[model samples]
Structure formats: C-alpha cells, structure tokens
Target chain A: MSNRSHATQERILAAAETLILGRGFSSTGIDEIVDAAAITKSGFFYHYADKNEMARALVKRYLEKDNQVFTDLFARADSLSEDPLQQLLIFLHLFAETMTRMEMTHPGCLVVTFTYERYQADEQVADMVRQGVLTWRQLIAQRLATIAEIYPPRLEVDLEELADMFTTVVEGGILLTRVFDHNKHLGRQVLLYRNFLRMIFSPDPSR
Target chain B: MSNRSHATQERILAAAETLILGRGFSSTGIDEIVDAAAITKSGFFYHYADKNEMARALVKRYLEKDNQVFTDLFARADSLSEDPLQQLLIFLHLFAETMTRMEMTHPGCLVVTFTYERYQADEQVADMVRQGVLTWRQLIAQRLATIAEIYPPRLEVDLEELADMFTTVVEGGILLTRVFDHNKHLGRQVLLYRNFLRMIFSPDPSR
Candidate 1:
C-alpha cells in the first residue's frame, strides 16, 4: 500500500474503533466511519472491502495497541515492586486506570459487546473476537506462571484457571460499570481480585 | 387489571423478553413485540406506556422467575450432596446448562445488552437495569452466605465478593460463548468456578 493509502486506512480504522466502542457494531455503519475519517465512500472501500473487514482490522489493530500500552504499565509495576505479589496487584490497578479512562467515553468492550451479535450472524467476525480473548487469556496466564515461579509453595494454583478468572472478572466489571454508569462497582471488583490474590500469596496460616 | 387484559399483557412481556434477548433492544421494536404477542398496538400502549415500561416489567418478571428457578435447583443440589463444596459444584453445572440454552435462543443478558444502549439515551431504563442487577446481587449473596456457613474453617469468605464473582464470571462466560458460538468456553468457566469454590473450602495444604 502507498504511504497516503496507508494513512487513509489508519484513519479509517481509528474512526471505526471509536464508533464501534461507542455505538456498538450493529448500530455503526461503514458510512459513519468514512464520514468520521473525512474520507469518501470510494476511499473507505479502498481501505476496507466492507464493514466486516473494517471490524477485523479494528480488532487486530486495537489488540496490538493495547498490548504495547499495557506492557509499559506491567514493566513499571515490576520495577517498582520487589515482591511478585505486590507487582501483580499494582499491575492490575494500573490496568484498571487505563481501562476506566477508555470506558469513561465508551460504556463497554467492543470485543465483548459485539461478540454476541456476530456469534449468530457472522462466523468470521466472531472468530476474530474469540482469538482476541484467547490472546488476552494467554497474557494473563503468563503473568500467573511468573507469580507461581516466584512462590514455589503455591503449587495448588492453576495459572490457566487464574487467568480465566482474571479475564472474566475484568469483563464482568466492565459490563457492570457500563450498566450502572458507576466506577464503584468496577473498583469493588478490583478489591475482590486483590483479596483473591492475597489468599494465594500470603504465608500459609499453618506455617 | 382485568383478567383478560392481565393475560394479554403477560404474553406481551414474554414475547418482548425473548425478542430483546435474540435481537437486542435497539434492533427490536414495540411493533414487533405486539406482533409476537398477537396484540394490537393500542393494547400494547394500554399495557405499557412505552417500550421502557415493558422492559421494566420483563426485568421484574425475570427476577421473580430466576429466584424460583434457582431456589429449586439449590434445593435439589443440597438434597443430593451433603457437602457444601459439592453443592457449589452442582450449582455451577446448573448455571452452565441454563447459559447454554439461553445462548441457543439469545446470546446476551436482556438487561445488559439493552442497558448499554439505553444508558446513554434513557436514564429511566438505565436505573431499571441497575435495580435488576442489585436485586440479583442480593439473591446470590444470600445463597453464598448460606453456603459459607456450612464450609469448614470457613475463613469467612466475603458473600458480596462471591456474588459479584459469580455474576461476573457468568456474564464473561456468556461473552466468550457468544464470541465463539461454542459451549466449551462456558463449560470451562463452570470448571474454573468449581475449582475456585473448592480452593475456598478445601483444607489448607499447609494445615
């Protein structure tokens, strides 16, 4: 793709992501993205064949951006805290801060909110969402594995299960936050997660 | 309300609930509910001042129905399994079954899917969803309290936390299931829930 064409495509994806996050996938249209990007209909199709293609690009680009964004928080968390347990808690808090800001403007997750709509109507789009979540799951699992390595006695812990719980709870918290229009519910979720981690990491009571 | 009118109104509410679940609130219309119920538009207005009013009725009715449904399942689970941990596992199993069926018909929560849309446009409907979730949280908290009382060395797990986690995971599982259009993700969620409960109940290995 030419440099100009690539810039136009980037503009189109950026606009679509904002719209999809705000209005949801079904309610948003390609024309709206094109309009938001200040590009014509012909220009929109040159970048994306259709709305589905745009959605796929949006998911892929969003995931890449998020991965880079969170990596800084994770590294800061690790550098600032010597204890793995503390690092985990701080990492989660930072994640929530970034997440809340993103959601303050958009009430819900694009992947989550659109997942159900595509599940029955469009298989390829649905697969993108599924893969996105699995990618999220893998990231969490890696963190858990690191924690388990640091705390060898925590043999009872299953990193995969913990990762799943983390992902689910985060998504759940987002849903509640949007539904109630309050960040308190999401904060409560963070508190609950921290407590769960405490249970696993604290010196065994019998020790 | 007259007996005939009450019956017609109930039918309309049920039809609205199913349609809202299947197509989402924004995509569904008052006319569709009337058509589904075989009632006239005038009758719909007589029963419910507007779509929001009908949504309120559906949420209230769903809460009542859910209470009865869960209570019956809990009673059966308690009778079949004397162990508190076993009861928790059984509950997860039952949750999975209900979720799978709901996905076959509609992939997201009627309150959640619509609440995201209406939260921006209608405060009245947003409060309706908040009330619905608060009622559910109370019901689930009570059940978790009862289970906590029976667990050994209980450590006094937080009932509110458990309820929040339960609610969160199910919603997340629904998101995953919808994204994948598969039952395995939900099944995995049930398994993870079972493990989490067992962790709370099982004897501390160090002990």
Candidate 2:
C-alpha cells in the first residue's frame, strides 16, 4: 500500500476503535467509521473487505502494540535486576506508573471489549483475543517459573495460574478504574499484585 | 401485577440478558426482546416504560441476585469457620468451586460487557454498573478488614485495593476462562488468591 493509503487505513481503524469503545462492533456501522476517517466508501473497502476484516486487522495491530510494550518493559526490568523476581517487581511498578500517567482511564482495551461481547460478527476477532491473552499468560508464566525455581512459595502455587493473575489484575483493574471513573486503581492493583509476589518470594514476612 | 405479567417480564429480561451477553445493550432492541419473550409490544410496555426502564430493571435484578449469592456464600463460610481469615478462604474456595462446576465457560457478565464498551446508550446503565462493582468491592473489603485485624500483611497493603483484587481476579478470571474456551481458570485464580492470602497471613515463609 502507498503511504496515503496506509494513512487512510490507519484513520479508519482508529475511528472504528473509538466508536467500538463507546458502543460495540455490531452497533458501530462502517459508514460512521468512513465519515470519521474522511474517506469515501470505496476507500474504506479498499483497505478492509468488510467490518469482519477490520476486526481482524484491529486485533492484529492492537496485539502487536501491546506485546511491544510488554517486551520493552520486561527487557528494561531485566537489565536493571539480575533476580527474576525483582525484575518482575520492577516491571510491574513501572507498568503501573505508565498506566497512571495515561491522560484517560485507559480507554478500554480492544481485546477486552471484543471478548466481553463475544461478538458473533467475527470468529476471527475472538480467536485473536484468545491468542492475545494467551501470549500475555505465556510471557508472565515464563518469568514466574524462573522465580519459583529460585524461591518457591510456602503455599503451592500453580505457575500458569499465577501468570493468568497478571492478565486478570490488569483487565479487572481497568474495569474498576473505568467504572469508578478514576485512573488511580489500575496502577494500585498492579502494586497489589507486586505486593503478593514480594510476600511470596521475600525471605521475611515482616520485612 | 399478575403472575402471568411477572413471568412475561422475567422472560423479556432473560431474553435481553441472553442477547446482551452476545452483544451490547444498544445493539439489543426492545422489539427483539419482546419477540424472544413472545410478548406483544403492549405487554412489554406494561412492564417497562422504555428501554431505559428495562436497563434499570435488569441491573436491579442482576445486583440483587449477585449480592444474594455473596451473602449466602459468606454466611456459609462463617458458619464453617470461627476465624475470619479462614472464613474468607473457605468462601473463596467455595466460590471457585461454584465457578468450576459451571457447565460452560462462564457466560459474560453484564457489568463487564457494558463497561468494556463504555456504552453511551444510557447513563443509568453505567451508573448501575459502577454501583454493582462498588457493592462487590465493599463486600470483599469488609471481610478483608476482618482478616487484617487478626492477620495483617508483611507489607503495607491497602484494604480497599486488596478488596478490589477479588473483584478484579473474578472478572478477569471469567474473561480468561471464556476467551480460552475453558471453564478452568476462574476457580484456579481464586485458589491462587487464597495462596496469596495464606502467604501474607502465615508467620512462617516456609509454611
């Protein structure tokens, strides 16, 4: 695609994302997205064969961007600390700070929005969402296994379940902050998860 | 007013909920709801003045049922254990079991579905959602405080934020389980949470 066409497609996806956040994929029509993007009908169809195609493209873009953020943050944390547990702690703390600095209360995630509705319009959208979550689960679970090898928790904890907790806290924290209309608790929840980790790993409880 | 009207009303709400689970409120029309209920338009109007009224009724019914479940489970836990912390652990264990026993991956929650889309359709719907989350937050926080009084954490933990974690894990766990097309993790997430509580409260790290 040419630079102009790429930009138009970007604009169209952006518009759809914004509307989908406020409503849902089914309620949001292609015409509204085209109008919002200042593109003609033919221009919209040129990029996406249909809304289902758009859903696929949007999830792909969102996951790529999300994975990049996680990779960068984890890599930076790893550089700062030799201990896997400490690295996770630092990563979560930094992650919370990033969310706290957001201008809005984390304008809902596309993966979450689509998953909650479980939209029948696109099976591919749901597949991508499941894939995105599993990717996060895998990412967090790998670090947790490293931590468990070095310092096993007093309680028998499942490494995979522990990993899913990170995803849970984030998605759940986003809901709480959004519903309560505060950007505050997403980071707080991350810290709480961090605290749980520290309690499990740190040698001393009172410390 | 009559039994027949009450049954019809329930049928309509149930239909609306079923549809909304698969989509959003805006995408679910009253006509469709009445059609699903096999009720005439006049019968639908008699029960609900408008879609706004239906939204209100749906939320009211949903919250009452949700709260009752919490109350009953907590009561059972309290009866089973004298210790507050033990009671919470038991309640969470039972809750997880309840979720695990679900025939299918837990259906999508209304509050979560609506909150994700950040629906612009009704302010009242949003308010009810916010209220429902707060109710759960308050419910969990009260139990956590009881646990804290007897067993404070090693780290400085915020009770309110900790309470929200229950809500977060649950809502998040449901999403994970649903997205993965498995009804497995919701309960496991609860157990992981229980382990976190155990780690925090027990004096010995190696215990």
Candidate 3:
C-alpha cells in the first residue's frame, strides 16, 4: 500500500473504532465508517475484504496499541524506581494520571465493546480479546511475582487474581466513568487499587 | 391485566434480556425475541409497543431482581452478625457464593449490556441504568459509612468511592468471567474486594 492508501486505512479503522465503541460492533456499518473516514465503499473494501476482516484488523490494531502503552509505562516506572513493588505502584499512578488526562478523548476499550457483542464476533476476534486479557495478566503478574520474592504478602493471595485486579479495576472504572460521566472515577479507582497493594505488601504495617 | 397476559409479558421480557445480553440491543431483533419466547410477533407487540419500551421494561425488571438479591443477602448477613463490618463482609461472602453457584445460569448483567449499547438506547433507558448504578453505590456506601463510624479507617479514604468499589469489582469480574469463560473469576474478584475491605477497616493492624 502506498503512503496515501495506508493513511486512508488508518482513518477508516479510527472511524470504525469510534463508532463501534459508542454504539457497538453489530450496529456500526461499513457505510458509516467510509463516510466518517471520507472514503468510498471501494476504499473500505480495498482495506478490508469483509466486516469480519475489518473487525479482526480493528482488534489487532487495538491490542498492539495497548501493548505499546503498557510497555512504555512499565519502562518509565522502572526507571523511576528499582523496587518491583514500587515500580508497579508507580505504574498504576502514572496510568491513573494518564486516564484522567485522556478523559476527554478516551472513547473506551474496544475489547470490552466487542466482548459485549461476542456473539456476533468470529472465533478469531474472540481469541484476540482473550489473548489481550491474558497479556495484561502476564505483564502485571510478573511484577507482583518479583515483589513477592522480596516481600511476602501479609495476606494469603493469589498472584494471578491480584494481577487480574489491575485489569478488573480499569475495566470497571471505565464503565463507571462512562455511566456516571465522571472522569475522576477511573483515576480514583486506580488509586484505591494502589492503596490495596500498599496494604498487602508494605513492610511497615502502619504504612 | 389477566394472569395469562402478565405471564406472557414476563416471558417476552426474559427472552429480550437474554438476547440483548448476548448480541446487544441494536443487533437483537423483535422477531428473534418473540421466537425465543415462543410467542407470536403480535404477542410481543401487545406487551411492548416498540423495542425502546421493551428495553425499558427489561432494565426495570433486572434492577428489581438485583435489588431483591442484595436485600435478601444483607438481611441474611445481618442475622449472622451484629457488627456492621461483619455484616458487610458476610454479605460479600454470600454474594460470592451465590455468584459461584449461579455460574451456569448467570446470563450476565443487563444494566451493563444496556450501558454498552447506550447509543442505541433512549433517554429513559439510560436514566434507568445510571440510577441502577447509583443504587448500588448507595447500598454499599451506607454499609461502609456505618463501619467507618465504628472503626475509623487507618487510611484516608472516600466512603463513596469505597462503596463504588463493590460495584466496580462485580462489574469488572463479570466482564472477566465472560471473556475467560470461567465462572470462578467473578466470585474470586468479589472475595478480593472483601479482603481489601478487611485491610482498610480492621482494627488490628496485624490482622
């Protein structure tokens, strides 16, 4: 694809994602996407053979972006602190800050939007979402495991479930934010999860 | 309404909730709902004037059922303990147990389903969802307030946000459960939230 064509595909995907997030995958049509992208039907067909292909492409792009964000945040957090637990906490703080700052532009997670409409999604799309969730689990659980090696948790906890809490809080936060139209809900929830981590792993009981 | 007609309405609402929860509101057609309910198209129309009315009715019925469950669980927890904190803890424990037992039959939350497809929902439906979330917040926040009075939290915390965590965990847990196809996720997440509460409110720092 030429530079111009690639740009057109990017625009198409962006438009599709916005529409799908607002309504849902089943309700968003190719015509609306093409119109929003300022492209023709042929242009859409050129980029995606069918709606299923487009859906697959959309999820693939979404997961890649998410992976990059997590990677960047963790790298930044590591640079700020050598302690694994502190790194994780710093990452959560940074993430909460980012969510608060992006409230205006944050359309919401496509994976979640698609999950609610999974009955309409093909197996490949479903698999991508599942893998995306697992990727998050792995990323956070690794840090928790390292922390556990140094500071055994005061309470008996499942490392994996605790890791999953990061995703769970974010997902639930987004839902509350959207429903309540309060951007701070996401940030506050993350901070609450951060506090939970502190209470669990901090050496000083008072702290 | 006659007894038979009221039963028909109940059937239509039940079928509509399942279909909407699966594929979303925009994708689910009246024909499909009627077919699922084993009723005629006229029968559906007789009960609901249009899809919007049906959506409203579905949400209303879902919220009532949820309210009843919480009420019953809290009542049971109260009978089990006099301490506000203990009652709250027991309520969460019972809730997790209920979720685990109902894994096979739990079709997922309709309020969440509608929130995802809010663009396709009318104002009334949206208000209903917003109110349902607030109700949860109020219910949980009341308990937390009572607990805080008895045992001032060691950490600085917002009672409302703390209350909101209950809804947040359950909502996020349901999402994980659906995506992972593991019923255990929801129950485990709830238990984790319960643990967090223990950490936040327990008088014994060691405990």
Candidate 4:
C-alpha cells in the first residue's frame, strides 16, 4: 500500500478500536467508523474486504502496537540493569508509569474487548485475539523465568502465574480505573505489584 | 410473586445474562433472550417491562448476588481464623476454590459486562455498575484495613490499592481463564495473590 493509504488504514483502525472498546464489535457500524475516520465508503472497502476482514485487521494492528510497546519497555529495562529480577521489576515500573502517564483512563485493551465478544468474530479473529494474549503471557513468563533462575524467589512462585499476574493487574487496573473514573488506580495497582515483587526478591526485604 | 412466576423470571434473567455476556448488551436482542429462556414474548415482558428495564434488573440482581457471596465468604473466613491477615487469605482461597467449582469458564461479572458497553446503557445502568464496583472495593478494603491494624504491612501497601488488587486479580483471572478456556488459571492467580499476601505478612521469611 502507498504511505497515504497505510496512514488512512491506521486512522480507520484507530477509530474502530476506540468505538468497539466503548460499545462492542457488533454494534459498531461500518458507516460510523468511516464517518469517524473521515473516509469515504469506497476508501474503507479498498482497505477491508468486509467487516470480518476489518475486525481481523484491527486485532492485528492492535497486537502489533502492543508488542512494540512491550519490546521497547523490556529493552529499555534490560539496558538499565543486568539482574533479570531487577530488569523485570524495572520493566513493570516503566509499564506502570506509562499507565500513569495516560491523560485519561487507559482505553480498554483490544484483545480483552475481543475476548468478551468472541461469539461475534470468526475463527480467524478469535485466533488473533487468543494469540495476542498468548504473546503477552510468553513475554512476561520469559522474563519471570529468567528472574526465577537468578533470584530463587522468596516464595514458590510459579513463573507462568507470576507473569499472568502482571497481565491481570493491567487488565483489572484498566477496569477499576475506568469504572471508578480514577486514573491513579492503575498506577497504584502497578506499584502494588511492584511492592509484592520487592518483598519477594529484595535481599533486605525492607520497604 | 408466585413461585412459578419467580422461577420464570430467573430463567429469563439467566438467559439474558448468558447471552449478553457472550455477545454484548446492544447486540443481544429481546427475542433472543426470550427464545433462550424458553418463554414467550409476553412472559419476558411480564418479568421485565422492557429491554432497558431488564438490563437494570439484571445489574441489580447480579450486584446483590455478588455482594451476598463476598459477604458470606468473608464472614466464613473471619469465623475460621483469629488473625485478620489469615482471615483475608482464607477468604481468597475460598474465593479461588469457588472459581474452580464452576464447570465452565466464568460467565464474567455483570458490572464488567456493563462497563464495556456503558455508552449503550442509561445513566441509571451506568450508575449501578459504578456503584457495584465501589461496593466491591469497600468490602475488600474493610478487610485489608483490619489486617493492617494487626500486621502493619511490611511493604507499606495502600489498603485501598491492596484491596483493589483482589478485584483486579479476580477480574483479570476471569478474563485469562475465559480467554484460554482453562479453569485452573483463575485459582492459580488467586493463589498467587495469596502468595503475595503471605510474602507481605507472616513472621517467618521462609520461601
């Protein structure tokens, strides 16, 4: 695709995601998305074969965006510290800070939005969302396993569960902050997770 | 209300919630709910004045049911142990075990369901969901405050944030388990929270 077309596709996807996040997939009409994107119907059809294709593209776009963020944060954390445990902790702090930096309650996650309306998507769309979550799990679990090898945790923490706890905290944090309209709760949850990690790994174990 | 009418009402509500959770509020039609409930259109109307009223009623019903379960579990935990920290831990275990007891992936919480589709709901519906989450936060914080008085958390945990962590864990756990079709993750996440609590408290430092 041309750069202009690519940019338009991104704009359309962003509008779709924002609408779907607030309402749902099935209820978010194509015309509404086109209007929001300031694109013509022909422009939308040129980019997506159908609603299913659009949904798939949205999931793909979201996952790639999320993966980029994760990779960037982890890379920055890795450069800052040698210890795998500290690196993971630093990564979470960075991630949480990003949440705190959001001007509004974080837009709810795309994979989570898809998960709730799985019945509306085709098998391909479902697979994209499932893979999106798996990707997150693997990324966190890899760091956690590295930490497990280095620190020998103060608790019998399952690496997978530990990794998932981060995902849960973010997802749950989004829900809490959105529901209560309190943006700080997301940061607090992240810090709470950080506090838990500190208590588990810090040699002195003093706050 | 007559027992028969009450039972039919439950049937309609159950069908509506199940459908709504799978798809979403706007996508789920009244006819689909009636068909699922195995009731006629008149029967559904008899139970609920309209779809809006049904949505309101469902939120009210779900919050009450949830409040009842949380209260019962905490009361049971309090009775089981003298230590406030221990009581809270026990409550999570029971809660996790309860998640395991479900034969299927959780249906998801009604408050959370409404949250994703808040734009579609009336102000009253939105208020109920907001209130529902607040109630959960208050309930969990009350217990954590009790624990704080006794334990003086070593990590300087915010009682409200710590309590919100439980909400996040469960909400996150439900999302993970449901997305993966694995019932165990929910219990495992709960246990992870339990483990975090243990690390935060307990006079013994043993892993």
Candidate 5:
C-alpha cells in the first residue's frame, strides 16, 4: 500500500475501534466506520473484505500496540531498579500515573468486549483473545517468579493467579470507571494492587 | 397481570438475559428473544413495548437478584461469626465457593455488558447501571468499615476503594474466566482478594 492508503487504513481502524468500544462490534456498521474515517465504502473494501476481517485486523493491531506499551513501560521500570519486586512496583506506579494522565475515560478493552459478545465473533477472533490473555499472564507471572526467588512471600502465593490479579484489577477498574463516569477509579485500583504486593512480599509489614 | 401472564414475562426476561449476555443488547433481536422464550412476537410486545423497555426490565431484575444473593451470603456469614472481620472473610470464602460451584463458565454480568454497549442503551439504563455499581460498593464498604473499626488496618487504606476491590476482582475474574474458557479463574481471584484482606487487617503479619 502507498503511504496515503496506509494512512487511510490506520484512520479506518482507529475509528472502528472507538465505535466498537462504545457500542460494541455487532452494533457498529461499515457505513459508520467509513463515514468516521472520511473514506468511501470502496476504500474500506480495499482494506478489509468484511466486518469480521476488519475485526481480525483490528484485534491484531490492538494486541501489538498493547504489547509494545507494556514492553516500553516495563523497560523504563527495569532501568530504574535492578530488584524484580521494585521493577514490578515501579511499573505499576508508572501505569497508575499513565491512567491518571488520561484526558478521557479509558476506552474499554476489545478482548473484554469481544468476550462478552463472543457469539457474534469468529473463532479466529476468539482464539486471539485467549492468546492475548495468556500473554498478559506470562508477562506478569515471569516478573512475579523472579520476585519470589529473592523475597519469599509472607503468605502462600499462587504467582500465576497473583499475576492475573493485575489484569483483573485493571479490567474491573475500567468497567467501574466507565459506569461511574469517573477517571480516578482505575488509578486507585492500580495503587491498591501495588499495596497488596507490598504486603505480600515486603519483610516489614509496616511498609 | 394474571399468573400465566407473569410467568410468560418471567420466561421472556430469562430468555432475553441469556441471549443478550451471549450476543449483547444491540445484536439480540426481539424475534430471537421471543423464539428463545417460545412465544409469539405479539407475546413479547405484550410484555415489553420494545427492546429498550425489555432492557430496562432485565437490568432491574438482575440487580435485584444480585442484591438478594449478597444479602443472603453476608447474612449467613454474620450468623456464623460475631466478629466483623471474620464475617467479611467468611463472606469472601462463600463467594469463592459459589463461583467454584458454577456448572458452566459463569455467564457474564449485565451491568458490565450494558456499560460496554452504553451507546445502544437508554439514559435510564445507564443510570441503573451506575446505581447498581454504587450498591455493590456500599454493600462491601459497609462491611469493611465494620472490620476496620475492630482491627485497624496495617496499611492506610481508602475504605471505598478497598470495597470496590471486591467488585473489581470479581468483574475482572469473570472476564478472564470467559476469555480463557476456564471455570476456576473467578474463584481463585476471590480467594486472592480474601488473602489480601487477611494481610491488610490481621494484626500478626504471619497470619
């Protein structure tokens, strides 16, 4: 694709994501996306064959962008501290800060939206969601494993479930934030998770 | 309404909930709901003027059923223990057990589903969702306030945010459970939240 064509596709995907996030995939139509992207129907058909194809492409792009964000944030966190626990804590602090900085309510997650409306999604989209969730589990559990090697947890901890807690809190926080129309809920939940980590791994309970 | 008419309305609501939970409010048509309920299109119209009206009714019923469940569970916990902290702990334990007993992947929450598909919902539906979330927050926060009075948390905690954590964990857990096609994730998350409560409120670090 030429530079202009690629830019059009990007605009289309971005518009589609916003619409889908707000109204869900089944309710969002091709005409609306084309209108929002300021492109013709032919321009959309030039990129994605159908809505399902668009959904697949959209999900792939979303996961890639999400993965990149995590990689960049954790790299920044790791650069600041050598200790695995500190790195995890710094990463969460940075994350909460990011949420706090958001100018708009965090848009809902596609994986979550798709999961609830799974009957409308194709098997390929469903498989991608499952993989995306596992990827999050792997990313956080690996960090927790390293932390566990050094500072034996005060309580018996299932590192995988504990790792899943980060994703859980954020997912839940976003839902609450959207429902309440408040932006602070997500950041507060992230900080609460941070406190949970401290109580579990810190030698001094007072900390 | 006559007894038969009430039973038919109940059938329509139950069928609508299942279809909407699976396919979302915008995608699940009245035709489909009437078909699922084994009623005529006119029958559906007799009970609900339109899909929006059905949605309002569905949300109202869901919130009430949810409130009753929590009330019964906490009451059971209270009857079992005089200590507020123990009652909170027992309540969480009971909540986890309920998730574990689910024969199917827990059907997703309507409040969450509607929140994501808010563009398709009316203002009344949106207000109900906001109120439902606040109810959950109030129920759990009241319990936490009682616990904090007795034990004095080791960490300086925001009781409201902490109460929201229970809803957060359960909401997130349900999403993860659906995405992963696993029954155990929700129960595990509830148990983890229970552990976090123990860590926060218990006087002895080792407990």
Candidate 6:
C-alpha cells in the first residue's frame, strides 16, 4: 500500500514539473497537474495541502537532482586533464551538454522560472530561491579559484567576480535561448567566454 | 483642450512607469495604475488600449530619451581630455552617476523590468527589448573601437564581445540590486568593469 502511494506521489511531482516548466508557474493550475498525473483531487490534496506546498516539494526535489549532476561533473578532477584551464573548459562543455539534454528531453530550470514568477508573491519562497542562487554562485566561485591557482602569479581577475560573471552569462544565455528558440546564440556566447578565459590565462604585460 | 488631454496622458504614463519599476510588470495591475494616477477606467483606455500598449509607449519614450543622452555624452570628443583611457573612465563614471541617480530618484530601468516580465509572455515586446539590447551593445562597441584606435594592436579586444559583456554585467548588476535591495553589489561590478577597461587599454606585453 505504501509503495503504491509513493509511486503515485512521484508521478504527480513529475507531471507538475513538466507542466510548470512549459506553461510557467502562475499559469499552471493544480487541476492540470493532477489530470496529467492521473490522480484525483483528494489524492493530490492528501499529499499536498495546497499548490504552494506542492511547489515547495518540487523545488527541493529538483534541486537535489540538479546538484547531484553538478557534483559528479566537478568530481574526478585527478583522473583527466592536468591543466586547470583545460579542466575548466571541459566543465563548460559539460554544463552546456547537460543543459541541452535536460531542456530538450525534460523541461527548463524550475528554480529560474519559479524565481521569476513567485519572487514577489511569496517572501519565503523568494528567500529560498535567493539562497539557492547564492549557493550556486559560491560553488562556481570556488571552482574558479581552484582553476586560477594553476596559473603563474595565479590570476589578475577576482575569482568571485569572474564566477558571478560566468553565472550571469549562463543564465542570461538561457534566457535569450528561450526568447529566440535557438541554441546558436548561446554557442556564440560560449566562444566569447573562451576568448575571455584566454585573456585571463595568457601572460599579461601590464602585470 | 489638447493641453489638458496631453497632461492627463502624460500623468498616466508616468504613474505606470514608476509603479512598474518599483514592483515589476506582473505584480502591477491596471486598477492600481489607475488608482495611482487618479484616473478613471475610461480615461486609462483613452490613453492606452491596454496595459501592454501602455508598456510599448513607455519603451518608445525611454529609448528616445536614452538616444538623446548617448548623443550628448559622445558629442564633445576634441574638447575633452586627450587620453582615450581617461575618456573611457569618465564615461563610465558619468554613466554610473546617471544609473545611481535613477535608482535613488525613481525606480531603476523600466525597459529592464518590462524585458524580464514580458519577454516570455509576449513576442512583439520581446523583439523590441532584443533590439534595444542590441542597439546598446552596438553603441558601446563603437565607443570601445574609438578607444582601441588610441591603443596598440594587440590591446584591442573584440569590441562587440566586450560591449556584450558590458551589457551583460550591467543587466545582471541591476537584477541583483533589485533582488538584494542594495547597490553595493552594483558598485563592485562597476569597479571590476573599470579595471577591465584599464587592462584592455594598457600596452601589449607580447609585442
């Protein structure tokens, strides 16, 4: 009985994620999610008191899965690529690959969509999104610092600032992609970023 | 009669702009805008067909004003300081001053808020925003090229790429400022940008 109940809850969550990503947070209703999941209203309310509660559960679950993928990608540093700059490049490629797969096969970033939709409506959810963003930025910053350490005299750039820039570019790129329905622009952005990376890693005469 | 009619329309536009900047596009409703402007529903529709139409008018007005400012900023080339790098610094300072004033005096960019809100919701408005962004990037690229003419060959980074980066940073900074309700982060971003300008304008070491 418990196994069947758990399965039903998972189905509902999966359906909610898809619906929210496609139609956005505010527009997607509880009725749509339950219908997609093949569940009754009573079953849905039994699991979640309201749509907000369901969204809270969805965000947490989505973040857990997303973080796992990020952790795995950043792991195995010693196994391949001795050069930190090359490792960073590999990470970028992997990041793009992961995003392409998820967006094409599943849906978009729930946190980004939710943040845009619900940030002003609900303070508690907004705080969660803000903290999540900070945590993600810190992760990128730490990796950038590690990569910067591989260079002679380290780097002239502030790793934290660079990380923020990187995060912004990726997020901004995703936004542009959604607006235009193309990944070609993001490819150009990546190339521009590569040049920026080269500018930093190369020997500086001004230094 | 026309003067009174014009004044009423202007008042409605101004009130909507202020409200949208402070609270975001989605959260601000027609009722609130009417309330804020002290206008009737009939009067509101007299000026704008709908909220979207009002936003379009606001965007057009903003772009006109922005174009005038840009022209003035770049007009005095010969009379100003001879140093290209110094000129760039002064430009950044002037731009920062205007941005700070906007935030302090009124809400931040109306176009920016509109872009984030309506980018996904409406296509025509999104195109307007995309063009607005592109035009700003192109203008900055022209400025960077002007600076590059005063420097050595290798010191000249891709002007378009650099301009795009500048736009990205400013947009990201403003978004962060809105989220955190602070300008310190924006200050840090501008400082970093100034440093980048210095790095680019400096002589090439490999030469």
Q: Write one digit per residue (lDDT tens) for candidate 4, span A1-207.
A: 489988999899989988888777877889999999999988999999998899998889888988998899999999999988788889889988886786264467777667766545478888888788888889888877766676777777777777788888888887777677658888789888887876766666764
**Candidate number achieving the greatest TM-score relative to the actual structure:** 3
lDDT over C-alpha atoms for residue B30 of model 4: 90
**Candidate 6 residue spans exceeding 4 A from truth:** A1-23, A29-46, A76-78, A82-86, A100-108, A147-156, A179-181, A187-191, A201-207, B75-89, B104-109, B145-159, B204-207
Which pairs of residues clash in candidate 5, taking residues 3 or more apart in a chain or in different chains?
none
* lDDT of each residue in A137-186, candidate 3, tens digit only: 89989989999999999888898899999889988888888788768988
What i-RMS does each candidate reach, in Å? 2.7, 1.9, 1.6, 1.9, 1.8, 3.1
Q: Can you write out model 4's per-residue Cα lDDT over B40-80, one digit (the tens) per residue?
A: 99888877778889898889998898889888998999899
Worst 10 residues of 6 chain A by lDDT: A182-191
Ranking by DockQ: 5, 2, 3, 4, 1, 6
Cα-based lDDT for every prediction: 0.72, 0.81, 0.86, 0.80, 0.85, 0.68
Docking class of 3: medium
**Could you say which candidate leads in DockQ?**
5
Per-residue C-alpha lDDT of model 6 across residues B20-55, encoded as one tens digit per residue: 776667668889989999999888998888878888
lDDT of 3 at A112: 80
- Measured on C-alpha atoms, candidate 1 has an lDDT of 0.72
What is the C-alpha lDDT profile of model 1 across B102-189, one tens digit per residue?
6676556766676555565566667767787777677667766766777653345666767777777777776666565466666577
lDDT of 2 by residue, A76-166 (tens): 9999999888899999999988877751733677787787765565788888888888898888888888888898874666777778899
What ranking emerges by TM-score with the best candidate at the front?
3, 5, 4, 2, 6, 1
DockQ of 3: 0.67
Ten contiguous residues with the weakest lDDT in model 3 chain A: A112-121
lDDT of 1 at B105: 61
Q: After superposition, how far is residue A112 of candidate 2 from its true place, in Å?
A: 0.5
**RMSD (Å) per prediction:** 4.8, 2.3, 1.5, 2.2, 1.7, 4.0
Q: How accurate locally is residue A188 in candidate 5, as Cα lDDT from 0 to 100?
A: 93
lDDT of 2: 0.81
Candidate 5 ranges beyond 4 A from true positions: A103-106, B103-106
Candidate with the larger DockQ of 1 and 2: 2
